[model samples]
Target: MAQTDLVPAARAPVLAAERLAVDGQYLTFSLQGEIFGLEILRVREIIGYTQPTEIPLMPAFVHGVINLRGSVVPVIDLAQRLGRGATELKARTCIVIVEVDAADSAQPMGILVDAVDSVLDIGADAIEPAPAFGSGMRAQFIRGMARREQGFIVLLEVGHVFALDELAALARGVETAEAQA
Candidate 1:
């Protein structure tokens, strides 16, 4: 199927809220060695590693685009994007398909994760504002820190992680690369 045929279906579910409580359930996953979470509602699906079609002139962090059914979804290495080095693909590694709400539309993107952990119900009492320092990833990408077990899981702000400006630049890069090719 053509990509335009797939765009609407891909963006529809990402904006709906499925939770009823003030506390949010987060789908946690590992990047490098640290754990991170995305509000469960933001995630669309998880697929095993599939090499994406390389798009030239794109950022080092961008793994390139994937033909998800029919839609061309950009896949990003979460670790590399955050300057933590590239993620080593393993049998357990998966591309987390997420719907990131953008200024013009709800954009569908893929985030490569080392491994997916269990979903945790982190209530408001257990969630704290992101610390100014010490967190491994950029502060802007972090939504908050959830206290769990003996440590913290950085909650990712999906919208910021897959910001439109960054993606638009990547799209431009694709065009530039194609032109030069």
Candidate 2:
């Protein structure tokens, strides 16, 4: 089967208020020896790492864009985005296509990971609220911490990770200024 076909078609169920309140299933992946997860709902597809045509003046984390079915989607390196050491693109590296919802629009974005892990069915009971201190990552970027058989998985807030609002606003502002010029 094709990679697109392997992507989960149906989204997992949202937790009810009465339930433990975890978001949904997560597609766990590794980066710099740490395990991190992204909400499976936002995941569109996963493809092996391929060199992307570099674009200038963008953020350091922005690895450039790729052509998926003719739609250009920007890719961000999760390792660099998380402030971890830079990752050497290898055979195991893969790009995870995520759909981030911007404040003004709903558009999908892609994130590159060192390696894609397994899909974990973590429920509310298994999750603990993110710690305020001692987490190397910014608190805003984290959703929660999940306990797993191997160890702990840092659940990432995919929307916040890309800071879609800030990026979209910046893009809009540039357009507006260009129009005014």
Candidate 3:
């Protein structure tokens, strides 16, 4: 029997490879009291909370830069970026380093979260379209909502959440102003 013999010809339509990639393991974490998830593959590492060197003119959510093995990496406060408010750093607070896509390359950035949660394997069937409201954050930042036993975990589209171009522009502005000072 051929592979097509398993399914009805009418129901054997294929989907794009990219579309199928959405369902996979996610690294879940908490922001405020709500749970959120990021694709595990993007995560580089998690480190203990360290005060970042504040960069003048950067946005409030941009917690400034940290030296990771001699490389300066900008840390973003996810709570404030999501409009929830600043994250009150506690014992469990840590930075989740993720590789976000830039214009022509991937840049490593840090996202500060309340605490790291467990990894979850969410299937496409368990995912739902982002709702129009009540997500707390902007709808565009959400990839989808993954239904879990506890509740729905807002799966973030990291590229949208951390737009490198916008950040780069702000950095350029700061650099220009500093040079003339």
Candidate 4:
């Protein structure tokens, strides 16, 4: 089956509150030797790392954009965005495409990770609230932390991680500064 086929049709839109409270599968991946997960429902597909077309004046974390079956989608460097330093692409590197809620719409975005791991079923009982400190990343970016026999999986809140509104505002500020200059 095609990667697109894995995506569910006619599925109910996931709400922010319900995203972390539900028990379901998570698509885990490795970044800088740490395990990170994203709600599987939000994931559309995964593809091998493809060099993206560079965009000028975008945030350093914004790697660039790619043409996805005709759609120009922005790709983010997950490690850099998390302040863990930029990811050094390897043979195992992959881009996980996900749909993030933005302004009453779902936008397709790609996140570059070190490698794609298995999809694990993480129960609600095994989840804990994001820590107030020492998570290494912004608290809002974390949906929760899940305990596994291997270790803790940092569950990411996709909407917060790829917040289009916040990014747009930041981009606007950059543009305004450039114009003033």
For each of the candidates, the C-alpha root-mean-square deviation to the true structure, in angstroms, is 10.3, 10.3, 6.8, 9.2
Q: Candidate 1 vs candidate 4: which has greater lDDT? A: 4
| Cα error of candidate 2 at position 27, Å | 0.3
Residue runs of model 2 more than 4 Å from their true location after superposition: 1-20, 103-105, 168-181
TM-score of 2: 0.79
Candidate 1 error regions (>4 Å): 1-22, 170-181
Q: Model 1, 15-65: lDDT tens per residue? A: 222221238789999977788999999999999999999877778888989
**Which numbered prediction scores highest in lDDT against the true structure?**
4
For every model shown, the clashing-pair count is 0, 0, 0, 0
**Candidate 4, residues 1-181: lDDT per residue as tens digits?**
6533444542322333355677999999999999999999999999998999998777778899999999999999999889879999899999999998877778999999999989999888888777789988898899989998887999998878889998888667777887888
On the 0 to 100 scale, the lDDT of residue 82 in model 3 is: 90
Clashing pairs in 4: none
lDDT of each: 0.82, 0.78, 0.86, 0.88
Query: Per-residue lDDT for 30 in model 1?
Result: 90
lDDT of 3 by residue, 53-168 (tens): 99887777899899999989999999998987899999999999999997788889999999999998999888777788877688768878889888799989898899998777
Measured by TM-score, how close is model 3 to the native structure?
0.82
* Model 4 CA deviation exceeding 4 Å by range: 1-19, 177-181
Q: Give the lDDT ranking, best first.
A: 4, 3, 1, 2
lDDT of 2 by residue, 1-181 (tens): 6443443532212221223266578999988889999889889899988787777656667788888888888988788777876777878999999888876776767788889989978888888777879888887688878987877899898767877767657556656776787
When summed lDDT is taken over every stretch of 10 residues in candidate 4, the lowest stretch is: 8-17
